[model samples]
Target: MANAISASPTSTDPGRIGVAVIDQDGKRPVQISAQFAVAADSSTRFQIVVSDLTDATEEVALFFCGPIRDGLDLEEVNQGPLVLSQAPNSPARYDSVLGDRSECSYTTSRLEPGHQTIVVGQSRYSFLARTGANVLYTVPGVRTVLTREDLGGETMAPLDPASTVSITMAGLPNDLQIAAAVPQLPDSGLPSWSYEVGGQPRVPGEYRVMGHLVTVENRAQATVFFAGAFVGISGAAVLWLIEILVTGALGGRPRGEPADRWEQTKERPPPRS
Candidate 1:
């Protein structure tokens, strides 16, 4: 494929991104779609479906440029040609072990002209995060690539510029209140991760970890005022007294006020009374 970028033996590749499909004909780019199922426990399931529109008579390579948390295994496939290329250090494996994650690529068996596969896997890996105290916390979201072979030593291709790829998150806790999400939203009102460069969509995923951004309302720490003083509650797992507001009397005395001064300073009734 003329549009395909070559991998460097020494330095990591930059174009490596989300799942990529190499079409020998390079006629049209493959179509890849993904959904991230995130659990409150921080565990995640990656459900991906990739299809090659070129539909070559021979087999082509399917490259996965993501974490190897559970290795890439097929959930379903078409009744055409296909093979698996995975072994110790084989070109087809999780992204990487220590350095240069871009070197990791998972190559799948052959696909006879325009084939699709349904893949479901998990990762103790990423895209989920939290900032701020428990009261106003955010559980934020949550890859790589290279070239080289199929059942043979394949050179995985970079994501095709014309390729259409979309990602969304799932399995969030029921109480989670979405405050904001990236790439904006539509009538669906659902939030998702957008992988793009320079405002253009479909950036590569191989070498870098990627995910969408989302801010959810943490009800427990959202905050509520009382008659006098507000309770400080930390949103973190191990709750702390209050990383924020302190106890200040609202109707009583006041914060930092000397008890004697407060007692002596009393309001007098109206002169007529």
Candidate 2:
């Protein structure tokens, strides 16, 4: 069996639902429809179904993005084509007013799969509380690859090992890029490491990575945040924001140049892992 994770429903608050389908073969984007029936005691039962027209294996992720009240119970029944699993929610610290949120995912196997459609018919017993609206974001497929190779032998050693990591996002309206400190390889010849993007090596120190999604009309910006590490008695909060240009053009800067044009004070520390 494929590995799976599950989470206990955390709240009874009426919540909004968001769903996205991920096709590994990059062939199909499934259409999803949801139905809700309110029960007595101010609870609701939600039924979400996905229609998969292609043969490729699919993964469906759901996010309960809401400012609803606390406590929800999610029961999965009649799972048509998907094997249900729940992964921890990604940080949504942007919305401070909302309390804790719920996020989960389900997967379908390439073999022994359903014929045409997958159903996630689950009942969510939630409380009737008016807080705010919850919206859903869909990511068709996300690809991540990480590889490492050792460079030392029994007698002779070069230094630290080399690593290659990449993250690919598909079905996104705009292109997204990410950069960060490569994992530290043990006792390497090089004192520090240089970050690379598109095969170009960047400066040798900690950098605030930035990515811009440019379109014909507007550009969207994203900044990479680094969590701080403690060295001794006192620790410093390392935070920086890279200005995303509307044109989505990235200018080449010399090594050791500041990645951010201006500095930003540390907001809330990067959401706790």
Candidate 3:
């Protein structure tokens, strides 16, 4: 029975990533240890687990940058709701049930003198997950270790006192820059993707929601090639025109002027006779 249970095909192992959350409510901040993993290859899956919530209805926001890929097309997967479960032994065990999911893409273009044309691809994902009857929530991925001292205590406050969580990736690319934003709480309802956050968004209270910014870059060589070809054609045309003008002046009949004196003389003698 033990061997049969261990060999079940329904099980999967998602790689672990480090993540940490800090609650900045009191004079001393409280840190919570969290774990995350990629659910599948077709889509980027992120799972976050924070233990011990003071209020089951309290909302927590997650913000981080996804792995950067080289391409113009920003690929995104449908995100599952923020799930809550008892402090599970593994991040993969958490279930996402109550939150909403969506997809979006952002782009910027640039033209440099010598470099190739670059189109910056940015895909950012953010959502609000309310705490449920349990403590675990599945929304994203990162890897870090936390202890009792870090979490402070079993009960931690939600987004308040302007708390911040930093996720560091080892061996990050040289050209990549990570950008994060904390959305402003809406007046009537939940926040939407349309609420743009330039660079980084700032809010007075702690940001209850957090998400990721996936930055990508795509270069097109056609623009530079076309520019070079245009410059070469223009130069050749200008030189050809200048040569025609110079040759005509040396022959005593510059461009736009009448025929040369010798031709005029030959025609005039026949007229006199």
Per residue, candidate 1 scores C-alpha lDDT tens digits across 62-173 of 4443344334344434443333443224354444321333443444544534476666655444444443211111221112233433334444444445555666666655
Model 2 stretches with alpha carbons more than 4 Å out: 1-13, 22-27, 39-41, 67-92, 95-112, 115-273
CA-only RMSD, every prediction: 14.3, 28.7, 21.1
In TM-score terms, candidate 1 sits at 0.47
Q: Estimate each model's TM-score.
A: 0.47, 0.29, 0.25
For model 1, give the 10-residue run with minimal summed lDDT.
1-10
Which lDDT tens digits does candidate 3 get at residues 1-273?
A: 212212211112122222222333332322333222222223332222332233322212232222211111321122222221223222222312111111111111111232112121221221122111111112322222222112213322233222233221122233322233234434533321221111122211122222221221222234446788999999988987887778756754434545665466443444555
* Highest lDDT against the true fold, candidate: 1
Q: Compose the digit string of candidate 2's lDDT tens values, residues 159-222.
A: 1112121221112223322212123322542212222221212211111112222331121111
lDDT of each: 0.41, 0.29, 0.27
| lDDT value for model 3 | 0.27
Per-prediction backbone clash count: 33, 8, 16
